[model samples]
Target chain A: MAQPNPHNTYLPGYKEVGHHEWRTAENSAPYLLPTLQSLAETNPSLTLLDVGAGSGTITTSLAKYIPQGHITAIDLSPDILSRAASHAASVNATNITFQPASVYELAQTFGPAAFDVVHAHQVLCHLDAPVQALAQMLAVVKPGGVVAVREIDMRVWSFHPFSETMRAWVEVQKATHAAAGGSNEAGPSLVAWAMRAGARREDVKASMGTWLYATEEERRVWGTSFRDRIVGGEMRKKALELGIATEAELDRMGEEWQRWMETEDACCGTLHGEILIRKPK
Target chain B: MAQPNPHNTYLPGYKEVGHHEWRTAENSAPYLLPTLQSLAETNPSLTLLDVGAGSGTITTSLAKYIPQGHITAIDLSPDILSRAASHAASVNATNITFQPASVYELAQTFGPAAFDVVHAHQVLCHLDAPVQALAQMLAVVKPGGVVAVREIDMRVWSFHPFSETMRAWVEVQKATHAAAGGSNEAGPSLVAWAMRAGARREDVKASMGTWLYATEEERRVWGTSFRDRIVGGEMRKKALELGIATEAELDRMGEEWQRWMETEDACCGTLHGEILIRKPK
Candidate 1:
């Protein structure tokens, strides 16, 4: 069994929430493509199994990318599915087939080994039984097929300017993770997160998580402070060149090592980091 | 001198705008309060001066903390100043003095060395000549007094799960910055941002910047991927302890990222962060 992660719990009304529009250019190409691309490479005719596909953003992108693929996406929200249906239509993607269902009960409705690629982004982190869900997804992927997932690790945030307010905010996050009975691991520690998610060490390196930082300073600070160290100096320098964050913010952040470290736990000095992983057969 | 950040070039029809209620608890305190707080420590009376105080969120917080100190706040927007006046009255903070005035021409109105602590939040970053404005703030503050300023980096943002239609809404920030010929450090790089207003080093460390990830995954990913070092066993663990984004929307963010990165050179990336700086002793 994976060790308990105190941070991935849930609070009734305090889930980390955001819209679909915030994804950046760097994140889209890899997480959203590989599975579909691999499937397309092997098939003359394709049917997609889009799990927890919200608002058909992926389905829409699929239409734009591989217009020939037939899509069947499943979700529990009619409010979302209805919009996904509309979005699919708006994008002029007619081959999509969406169902109002949960991954828990999805296989019951559809036959096993039905899709060329069973895919999702940031989904398993929310489920109570992720391993079982993975099993379900595996059952649905034909032998030699692919299962793709994208996740964000919150443990990567290393540069929060300290304050009483940030302290309170971190507390709220801790409470949410505790509430979830420890099944979630998306916050800053993506490597450990991958291990907990059942990924092997080799896979972690193969699919490095791509994080989005606001400024060069943040990226630099994060690069120096986060564990994965997958990106830092060059990435931060590029962001500076690209105008992400200021050198001053990055410098001040370096001086700020004390505040995030004030916790009596002795380990407060380090914050979060994120990583992306994939399974290759 | 710096090729007026491409993001700062002006657009044809856009106008200045600010959010009284930023969706997340942006913790703008780092960018504005550090300078003011440092100043407060030296001058026991903590008498305060608020330039372009707008609706006086700081004025109220100051009054709450320094009940014995006198407070004077000014703003050019009579409409906004009226609200400050009413709120001061409602709070029974008679020690605060409000004036209707413009920051562009402060010397003609408020006397020199009028305050021990001068402050403004989310104000200077929007002006035409921020340097002149910072100098004006210096003029109002006593030689040994502190002058503080805060602003939203306005750059680092993942609007998704917050507002989907404008998920790449940070483009709006770049557009606004480019139009002004100012540095694009308005968002996630607020720490470095204060320097644009001409803040010095001692004035900066006390003043900091903050980044709020929407979920535990974000925090963890940041820590492990970017914040950690080559010598590591996950330096420290940062758990999702909170939910900041949903599984479905976050999963679909990759597609949004792709579209978000496709802006004119003037617009790109999510920009958001805050900075607080103190005037010199």
Candidate 2:
């Protein structure tokens, strides 16, 4: 019999929720596109690998940029990969392929020196061994190719007219993630992780970016998504099981989220740490 | 005909950049100590007022569990107020007075209601009104009392694996502080500032805290000091002259400081947004 995986608590819901909220142009382009453009500038017909390619929103977008080139989108969830495949087909993005694979097993499955660029966004923070995953990412990228990673530095998450409910929610989220052996600190630590994973320090180019949800519509989307995640998703169950928050507290936080969404001047956003490293030729 | 104020550039190097290094057990204790104790169930006698009491590393320590007490330390840079009077006479302390006025004249120099608790740390974020200097520290406190403020949201200052000469330093540091005519995003936008200045939000209790450099001598200080002010303070001059980085850009950031310090695993600290507003009894 197969043993149950402890960290699997949050993954099932994450796949069903689909990451479509993050798929919007407003969220993805500011950080992902620039790195892709920079790489495209160097090799117009590059072959790229999109690791943890959630719903293929970013992958298909990258496919459009490299019309003559190709992209292989991979993920651990077959459900997400199926959705990603459907998304690629809907977009008529022919230059991409979708696969099911874990980032840790990438080198073994794809062979070494297989990609011109390897990219992942908001992914590594959820991995138990981000550095090892980076090593795998590095292994599959050809010499002189680029490996780009972007993750949110949760410490920078802030909002105006502070909310205690939001604060408690953030605490619960962090504790749940930590209990699952993941990190919210992954974003700011990207460069350090890359260097530790065998990339030379001098070869890493680090930058910071943000996703601001300030306008009414944007805030509605952001707040509602978070409210659903907290009140309706498995996160609430995971949090309770972990003893990170009681049900009453979670209910209070959900109400707080509703109140926050209704506040006129309310705005919130997150910071992302981005890094682009060139594999030594 | 008036001579230009030399200190206008950055407050004459903030006499207590000593607060920047945060090396002593005494320095870290004040801010962290009281908050923890307050969460405990106790009456905690505290007749306090710490107006711009720079480096009074003791105001907060005294705030902890003072069952029958008073504390009033004020400052407007008298030579006697040097380094917050040697951090309250280097520990052999007695609750006392150190006054000099001007938190917008302070209810005609401490007249109305005069105390139960009226505190300020890193006061008024350089006050261009400062909600009428927090309505003169809420008309000198005591109709249910408790007025506290702490600021500094240095979100635009960044350095990476050590930028050759701190590239973005001059641009961001100046724009953020200058944009507000004060601080980038001083602590929680003082509730008293809101209530006194006619913001619709009701008075609310808010608290924010931060980690400071303690051990690991190499990480001893990761904050801007007057030394940086005196020697490398061209940021003020550059911001005014070039206008390369906009006020909008400065307003959007609050993560740069965290990223820079973490790169070297260097110890750094931030003053947090804290507010405690008590409704009339």
Candidate 3:
């Protein structure tokens, strides 16, 4: 069992029902090559852990990739964890198990030297103590095992058919992250944070990956997901409470997303930082 | 013979020695997959044209990829063309030939339907008349063949260890492009430009690519290349003439590049837009 950290406040909160659709295991394809290679080198039956396993999209997807390997997918909210468990069941991902856990409790809950691989995607930026959380993660991974993390740098997000409303939307996102006391643009600092968490300089390797929305289908899917997250999700309430944007302003951004979807030649690209840290034997 | 367009002025001009090392065929790899597939489907002996082919790096590299195919590599400056020709010889690229030509002359110089494929890399954004040039490129490609173009969008370039001088460096680059009457951030509009250039809306496909410099070697190479471009290249004289930046400011930027090279965890990513338009049969 794990207890949630009282200090953590997540942005675009987990209550956003449709938010996870935008972050499927497919969205995480770029970060998986090295890990998949590692899995191949190791045994297929090795244990892996997924921290902050939102919606179980990536967790369930990983079940398919390593059918024989067992995965412990943990998150803080039982409500979200149950939902993710249901999703996993629906997808027939039997190799994955769920737990209500927080980043702060990972080492204690799982014990030391547990997982062969520890992976997190888009989770660190939302945590209040990412470096501390990383240290805990490092503790749970076996000596000589690897911990992989991927984070987005919204500062570099580029979108086509520029609109003032869209620009404000990006700013509001950054503000909301600040209001929640987390770093939204944490991609560039992953390597530095790993070092601060006690990983040696030589133990960390960094690379960049990208997310692009260009095709009509991709644009529509992304636009709808974001619009829903802002309009009907907890994000709308939080933003208004934080005074990041007015209700009417949020509504306008929602409308702008639909317009962006319809506009031909619309495109958006976001860069993500990937870090692989090896625990010394 | 092809004549240079009198109205055109290129930023970071061709006379910048060592500039071509940064843009080898490997740099253009992302844009080549579809084009390479097209080449494979077509006859191996089909003709290809490289407009604004700089340094003969991409041109000569392509020669090896398709040994039976022939490449006509064109640029505006005879001096640069001679250098590229010498480079091609040094590489022993037997299938490539260099020509001193401007984008404006492609149609008349090649005649209608002269080649199976036409490609341009980082060229359209610098041209005075990109749409006309694209239209000409379309006219020269065989019916059912493709015209591929790639342009950088500097507005979204992101770098780590942020400094005021580095920000100024990016702004000065945009300023120089503006002074030369070119669109520095032309990436997002690539699809629109292609449509305006006479391709039907449905005939064009757009994708985004990225350039990342993260490793120690990559940081040093990129930093050195830009420092040289700012210090000893034609760009320095042109920026001064255009009043884009003072000599002293440019020198400070050059020094900042050296500092950035030495800084650990330095990373930069630049996004580019790629377009492929198919001619109607």
Please give, for residues B1-281, the per-residue lDDT of candidate 1 as tens digits. 11122122122211112223232212444344445555556664777777766666667666665667788888766766777788778878778888876665665567677777676765665665666666667677776666666554443342222335334223433453545455444332344344555665445432223344333333333323322211111111111112323333333343343333331111111222333344555
TM-score of each candidate? 0.40, 0.57, 0.88
For candidate 1, the TM-score of chain A alone versus the native chain A is 0.61
Which is the leading candidate under TM-score? 3
Q: Which is the better candidate, 1 or 2, if ranked by TM-score?
A: 2
* Model 2: colliding residue pairs: B151-B187, B155-B254, B188-B273
Is candidate 1 or 2 superior in lDDT? 2
lDDT of 3 by residue, B107-136 (tens): 788799998889899888887778888888
lDDT of 3 at B111: 91
Off by over 4 Å in 2: A1-12, A15-19, A24-26, A29-35, B1-281
Tell me the spans in candidate 1 whose CA falls farther than 4 Å from its real position.
A1-281, B1-44, B159-164, B173-184, B187-199, B206-281
Per-residue lDDT of A70 in model 2: 90
CAPRI rating of model 2? incorrect
Worst 10 residues of 3 chain A by lDDT: A1-10
DockQ values per model: 0.01, 0.05, 0.48
Top lDDT hit:
3
